[model samples]
Target: MVGVETSQHVQLSYEPAGVGDRVLAYLLDGFFMGVYFFVVFWIWGYWYSLGSDPADLSLSWVFYVVIVLPLMLYHLVSEVLWKGYSPGKKIVGIRVVKVDGSRADLSGYLIRWLFRLVEISMTSGVIAFVAVIMNGKGQRLGDMVGKTCVIKERKKAKLEDTLFKDVSEGYEPVFPQVTELNDKDIRVIQDVLDARSHYEYDTWFKMLKRTRQKLEARLGVQDHGMRTDVFLETIIKDYNAIHGSVK
Candidate 1:
């Protein structure tokens, strides 16, 4: 496990898979590619065996193109649309992201796919597999070209189980309100929390003021004097409280 302190509030932890998830993804992709390649090869061979001129043998490239197209397209679409995890990757709970902690884009995806040829050149992609295991960021040559890293999503810790392990239970906040907040506001708060280390006290103060203003505008509340940290904490506490009760 490699711990990257992305920010004071967001400690990004990399859960390294010991040759398990990678092997699984490789097996799944290999299975898909093998099936696809076999079908295309069979069709192409059949078409050629039907007395089609050997001079036109280059048409077999079409099958290769067809097979390659889906692989490229799937990666591009999944990275851009779903922020990384293709069906196989999602099933295995691994996702790719840029080194700077952003989602991969079209250029990055293309670079990744193009460089994958180098990674998989030798039999079984053992070189790439070794690179992933040895690299600090769990990145292969393709991932280096794409400036991406694979990471597993952190499992959500059960609050009740941890919180009550030491204390005798019945802890509650002083006030709870089921106030509505907009998605943009929520994203802003999350971003702020994620940027804690990059921001100074004055910068945080300014952001808090802006957040409060945005909250006031969105929620139509004229007076919300709670400090930004307190406000966020309260909202999360109330949400957990209500959510726990409902569950």
Candidate 2:
């Protein structure tokens, strides 16, 4: 799990996905691959048992190469272009990211795939599955080696309700003098207000406190006795009202 604390009214947090999800994903991938391999093996067996000349066995390697290359190409192309997610993973709503909270790059993807050989070679991936099950962060051998973790996609929050609630009820702004907020501060505020209803009360309160501190420091405004939540509600309402009128 990684905790991100913003110095504004935004509480963004995420947990690494558990082993059950990973196992299900693996089984899905395996099912697809199994069907593919069955067709390939059937063709190979038919070709080899034809009682052809021994020299024709040299051409059997060609069939093996043909069978393996497409699977490899599929992995290579999808991971590089889609940021560590294949079509299946995308459908499952899981994505891989680096430990530093960035998208997984080409190198990370390659490393993870390479390490997957070790995972596959150990008791038909039983060892790797167990490792993910036991690990605190739900990391398999490949994930540990690649320094990546799977995370669920977050739902986008609705901003209109949180930002304009009290304003629609005729609430007045208390901090009238604070101005010239930066883009980052504004974004943090937008995120916080948007997701206000999704988070716990304590989390919301902490975000409000941080936003108040940052706003006061940046604008050099003296703090009024108003509650942080009330101040935020008032400011967002004022902004929306002013901006809405201009449009």
Q: Residues 101-218, candidate 1: write the lDDT tens digits.
A: 5566777777876766667645468878888878857688888877777777656556443221222247574334434643333444555544455567776666656665555565
**Candidate 1 — worst ten consecutive residues by lDDT sum?**
159-168
**C-alpha RMSD in Å of predicted model 1 compared with the true structure:** 7.8
Tens-place lDDT digits, model 2, residues 28-118: 7667777888987787678778875657656766656777666656555776788867666666667777764468777777777777766
RMSD of 2: 5.1
The total number of steric clashes, by the backbone 3 Å criterion, in model 1 comes to: 0
Error of 2 at 134 (Å): 2.1
Which candidate should be chosen as best, given lDDT against the real structure?
A: 2
TM-score of each: 0.56, 0.70
Candidate with the greatest TM-score versus the true structure = 2
- Model 2 is weakest, by summed lDDT over 10 consecutive residues, at 160-169
Which regions of candidate 2 deviate over 4 angstroms? 4-11, 34-65, 73-76, 157-187, 190-207, 245-247
Give the alpha-carbon lDDT of every model: 0.61, 0.65
